[model samples]
Target chain A: MSFSPLIVRLMETLRCLPGVGPKSAQRMAMHLLERDREGALALAETLQAAMEGVGRCKRCRTLTETELCAICSSHTRDQRLLCVVETPADVLAIEQAGSYRGYYFVLMGHLSPIDGIGPNDIGAPELLRLLDEIEAEEVILATNPTVEGEATAHYLADQVRRRGLKVSRIAHGVPLGGELEYVDGGTLAHAFAGRREVTA
Target chain B: MSFSPLIVRLMETLRCLPGVGPKSAQRMAMHLLERDREGALALAETLQAAMEGVGRCKRCRTLTETELCAICSSHTRDQRLLCVVETPADVLAIEQAGSYRGYYFVLMGHLSPIDGIGPNDIGAPELLRLLDEIEAEEVILATNPTVEGEATAHYLADQVRRRGLKVSRIAHGVPLGGELEYVDGGTLAHAFAGRREVTA
Candidate 1:
């Protein structure tokens, strides 16, 4: 009635990807099998290598093959400014934005009490210890704009303040090129509350 | 300036999938490396097993680990009615529809002169030989509703007719749930020309 066992298994496994459902999984499986077997093989090898070799960076907790991730290990990056983010994807996003020469600390997740995630679980304690050990003068809270992200950022700010370090949250405002009419109420309110003088 | 070499390589390799652009490929790579490492390992193993083991079924040219695909080897399926199609995805689509019970002959492609595809490339000679060797009573041309598909169907129909075999094309018409207003003119004309009398 359906595909052979291996084909069915492959399709099911492909659904593990983010935003992929059954139909998309089927399409991807067929495409890999039909057009790019060599690419599929290479992907499989890369996945294996990444899984078996990659682990959390000792300093920042981001994924890397070595003890420290590329960002954490680089000597040229500014160690005085630390950007705290919720996941590796956020690190990549900030990197792609073509700004920010500071170092990063990947929390890997935010505080979700319902999901049993606490400070220690997301490496918050390790982050505190690393902040104490490092010469970081400022910490930037760059978690996503969500309830849990806000909670995590507040918690981190309190902890960093206790350690006598300057803590600043990333500015919440309308995105660049965004029209005020289309901006959500929460963002509009934040923009109004955090208004700065037009010194320029 | 970017992700580590391994991460970069993984992201590049993931772009081989259809519809997966650079951003999506990066997302997939980060997801595999960060959250679901175990799932990624399993996917890698599965991909390897599938690529190294799965091959075309000798009888119908559909993908299978064995000499014959499930449909080709199954005795319960009606071998008398053969459905010809382009690609294994078409076979899966028809199977999901749950109406067809006949066996299939997967051509893997349509005849496209512009791209240099010919009858031999689609295994038409093998199909003709199989038709002669089997007890097939009717052949169904189920290629897509494209110009190349129509040409391939006409060619196959002529070949089958020369062997004194009956051939019928899958009907072209407005889909069962589609509105006539949205239906294209070519399909509307085909529906009108292929009109049948209602006996009721």
Candidate 2:
């Protein structure tokens, strides 16, 4: 029902994006071909360049154009404190917070046996290989607070504790500026359980 | 706060699409780079090919890879009944209805004086020239019901009527399956005013 095959292909290709649905894909195709062809061309070029060039950082599994990611290459970063997270996006999120100075180990996904995802599927073997090379004092479990994420964290903790390394989970608590009444029950319980002594 | 310049550029370029914000752009970039590199490459190729190859049909201004659009070139379509719409997306919508065998003249935009978009800006001159070549019996205005659309339709009607060609506007009414209570006042009024005699 599209105007042309190229147009239809463009629309279909756009639907591969994370959240773009059929309607939004149609709108995007129309808008690009009509008003922003130059921008669209730029997007295409950049997309191709990135897809061909970017690869996982050998050390941390974060996406990079080179063998190692910026954090992994930087000598100033704390090599002893490795942050374990589920994806490269978490690495970016932590970087934006401007607090963490450690290297990262990106799992890319959590252990999901039902979906056929195992420890090796999410780069746990790679992480283990790197851990053997680097003298790490502590490993931070920064995976998401989902059921699968918790399971992954427990598994990683078990593996890391076998090497006698310190393990710490990023605290689950009420978000800053969040109202207590509106917080979900699970999060509220986690916040209550993980409460620390009030400081002056 | 991203990993690499190319990745950042890809994310920024993706934001050019309508309704895509920073967060979604980030997610799209991550998803494409991490999970679907081949699909991302295909999308890039399709986008580039489409942007380069697709152009306005010489006859009716719809997008095409060739000189004439499919509808305009089709002998079965009612060439004498030309439908004017604000965008190629509208043409697709009409085509999807499985009705409207008439050709289309895509305006691409409407008159928006505040934004400096006028008659000429939206290819009014080209439309006028096409009108002279085609022996069209009627020109159907299917522009949106917005203020700008109404003004554009009125202006087009005035211009088309001077050629002694019949000009008709598509009816504005409560949408199919929309409740009367939820429908806007102006649309309800238009629906009431344009009411027709009941048929058996």
Candidate 3:
């Protein structure tokens, strides 16, 4: 016998979440139905509000309910130093690190020609327009180190150079606290190739 | 720098699902916002509907939108046999195995006095009332093998026996496909104690 129609539907709909499968969906649905109805209802309200209200920031393309995101609207952030990344989550990661003081432009996704995603698809034109409008002296390409991310950064770097603005890509090397024995060949090669001069 | 207020709220609310932590919550929020807004909205609607509409089945107490669950309402299931389980998920597991064709009575939770849960809290009185009203000649206790489950089954068995019904606890032993050498000592003892004579 199957679960009631509503229970089944809830389980099926829960699979839309990343990394959630049939078993996890069933467990989550049952957990909500059996234990935490209040939490489930609150989650529903928050999801609806976010999905309907959250939109891309007009300036940086990061997710925001208002016209501009927190960083874009802030007066303290260095607007002259702009950083570009792949997704909003990447922005959060940098923010949590508590080092970067510059504003960001979210690309949402990297270039994927095989999937038919182009410069226009990832809002490249909008990024370029922001470059022209802002007084940014430097643009940091903080996209991931994957092939597609590298290709997207290279393409954006060419565009930034055309406007005579300084452009730089984030370093790719061995991660901090990583053991050399466990480090992969490609990372080792990058680490060696990008080695910096030691200070006296 | 943090996510916009709405996005942060969405991420926090998404943690209500079982096994989801801060990192998973952030990934899910970004995934829904960046890649699948439609799926996010649909999940929200389904969560709301299920949270508000789904209720306990009047007969079996499994989750359902109607008075009786599918198994309880079915004409094909055995009315003279009743299986008592700790949760609705247990009923689903038994049903998915495709062996049992009897009606089920969900206790929602096992007896756990440490957590302040008592017989009345888990609907034990309702289960007894149902037993008195039904034509069930045999009752099966299919609660988990944990301590609370064993105690619950033993208590319910006494009540069923007082009413002159045959009640039996599901067996505990080494599981199928598990190696004998790898099985735990308690299971080995249970297997030895519950051994039956083979028919010639």
| Top DockQ model | 3
Using lDDT as the measure, name the better of candidate 1 and candidate 3. 3
Off by over 4 Å in 3: A174-200, B174-200
DockQ of 1: 0.62
Give the best candidate by lDDT: 3
lDDT by residue (tens digit), candidate 1, A1-200 = 67778989999888888888887888788888888899999999998987888888999998888888878878999889888888877776666554577899989888999999999988988989999899998888777667788788888888888888888776667575432223455664464345332111
lDDT of each: 0.79, 0.79, 0.80
Docking class of 2: medium
**Least accurate 10 contiguous residues by lDDT in model 3 chain B:** B191-200
Residues A1-200 of candidate 3 have per-residue lDDT tens digits of 67889999999999999999998998899899999999999999999999999998999998999998888989998877888888887776666655567889998888999999999988899999998898898888777777788799889988888888888775566464432223455654454345332211
Give per-residue CA lDDT, model 3, range B1-200, as digits (tens): 68888889999999999999998998899889888989998999999999999999998888899988878888988888888888887776666655567899999988898999999987888988998898998888777766788788778888788888877765566575432233454654454345332211
Worst 10 residues of 2 chain B by lDDT: B191-200
True contacts kept of each: 0.72, 0.85, 0.91
For all candidates, the clash counts are: 0, 0, 0
TM-score of each: 0.85, 0.86, 0.87
Residue B139 of model 2: what lDDT? 82
